[model samples]
Target: MNAEAARTPLFDEHVALGAQMTEFAGYLMPMQYIGIKQEHLAVREGCGIFDLCHMAQLRVFGTSAFDFLQYLMTNDLSRLSVPGMAQYTLICDDDAGIIDDVIVYRTGEIEYLLVANAINRRVVFDWANMIRDRWSTHQPCGESAPRQGIDLEIVDETDRTGLIALQGPLAIPLVEQMMPEGADIPTRFKILATTIGPTPVLLSRTGYTGEDGVEIFTHASNTAAIWRYLLSFPEISPCGLGSRDTLRLEMGYHLYGSDMDRGVDPISARLGWICPADKPDFVGSDAIRRIREQEDHRVLVFFTADDAIPRPGMSLSANGVEIGHVASGTYSPSLCVGIASGYVPTGYSRPGQKLDLQVRRKQVSVVVVDPPFVQGTSL
Candidate 1:
């Protein structure tokens, strides 16, 4: 690990568990604990815990916060009927290119928290602050202004906070035990602010593994103790990045840099669902609206190979014409087959379409398949 790369407070604990460490998004994190396949199954069948403190957390407050977020994100923030609800959204650039896919949580009437990928955290912060700065320097609109006394406060709370994801069919019950007596688990897409023992925390029923889970956020100093307490449950297995990737990939979830990037528009990635056309204007709304109305020549798709494993950069062809290249691929532990996702000509992206995946020098037969390779028990 590079000397300057930041380590989560659980780094020492990972070493104690004899985890195989790897560098990802500038963090020295565990890639696997016992093994990827075992951990993946544990999460599906029982429960698994992951250290997710590397993800970035930002807080936006003040009277202008809601307006600022509504203008900044693709999903409609007004859909959150009550505080403590969470929305999966995208923050895109001016051209409707996805800068990052993020989750926005309404923590209060005027306060929200945005969670961004670790590698794209700074980019998100810079983009959001730029808008806040512009709004702060301007005067309010005439009598029709949305609100009065508007001010914006943006804070990056990544380093000061620790996060852990407990996911699986049993996650809710396990997490409930850790919460203070009489406290209840939050409903799906909802958040709860409460305490575990003496540690203050925010628990959200959101996860990347396509499973029922709660992501707990607490003070960085309290992470180690919380981690130990959770692991005391004999059924809770410790998972790492390797299993996390396979699990999410199995669910057809997009990884920030791999599946979508600053260069890829939401329409091409088939992420238009997050960009509701009826929502109030937001960044890239014009471009996204245009893109949505037009047909994209290429679209992302999921395919499976029976005999060959697909890897990123591998080529895809149909009828001897190069169509696209693999974006993300791995041997799916759950399906017991090689599955991949990539951009293919729209004609070849439909389920049951036959395409050839170039694995090294050999052409392997692959068939387009509908995603959620495995149905996740999220609710």
Candidate 2:
């Protein structure tokens, strides 16, 4: 591990379990407990627990919190009419370039919990603070003074909070076992203020893997206790970043740096669904609208190969001409094949298009398919 790398609250627990740790996004995280394939299969067939403390957690609250977020996020915040509703939204720059994809949980009428990717934590925090400061000081041109600046506060809770995910078909049942009697279990895409044992947590029915699960957020001090309790249920396996990557790849989910970045807009990334046209104008609304009107030069596509596994940076070509490079690639444990996603010319991004993937020494034939290489999971 790098000398500067940070460790999560469960680092000691992982070390004691003989997990292979690696530095990822400035955090020393478990790469694997036993093996990627074993952990991957565990989530597909049963349950897997993951330490997600590396991800950033931000809290936004106050009178103007809704308006502040409404102006910054591409998705409509009004959909969260009540508390405990979680929405996946994209934070974009003025030019509609994706800054980061985050999930916002409406924890209160004027408060929300935003969860962002670990690697983009600082970037998101800085950008949000800059915007918040500017928005708080803006005065109308005709007004003599700025109306009482919208009341708002953005707090970085990354260091003080710990996140854990219990994923798979058995995840909900296992969580229910720990819940107080008569406590309602949060349904998919929802959240609940609940307790496990004596520790209070914000439990949300969400996950990156294409499976049914819940992510629990609690005080950093309570993380290890929760992790140990979850693992005590013999059915739950401790998963690492390796299986997390493979599981998400099989579902055709996008990774921030790989599938998108400051240079890529949501329209070209096949994530336009998150940006509804009926919503009020936002920071990137104008730029996104322009991009949506024009034809996309390159579009993201998901593909699979039978004989060879695709790897990131591998060349993707067609008719003996290079088109693009693999953005994310991995061997799909469930499908028993290699699956990858990359950007290619819009003309060749259809589901049945054939492309050639340069897998090391040989060119392997690949077929562009609709998202989710593996199906019939417990999602």
Most TM-score-accurate candidate: 2
By lDDT, the best candidate is 2
Q: For every model shown, what is its TM-score relative to the native structure? A: 0.95, 0.97
Candidate 1 residue pairs that clash: none
lDDT of each: 0.89, 0.92
The digit string of per-residue lDDT tens for model 1 on 119-198 reads 98899999998866554444333223334466889999999999999999999887777778888788888998998667
List candidate 2 segments past 4 Å from native.
137-147
Clashing pairs for model 2 are none
Per-residue alpha-carbon lDDT of candidate 2 for residues 22-55, written as tens digits (9 for 90 to 100): 9999999999999999999999999999999999
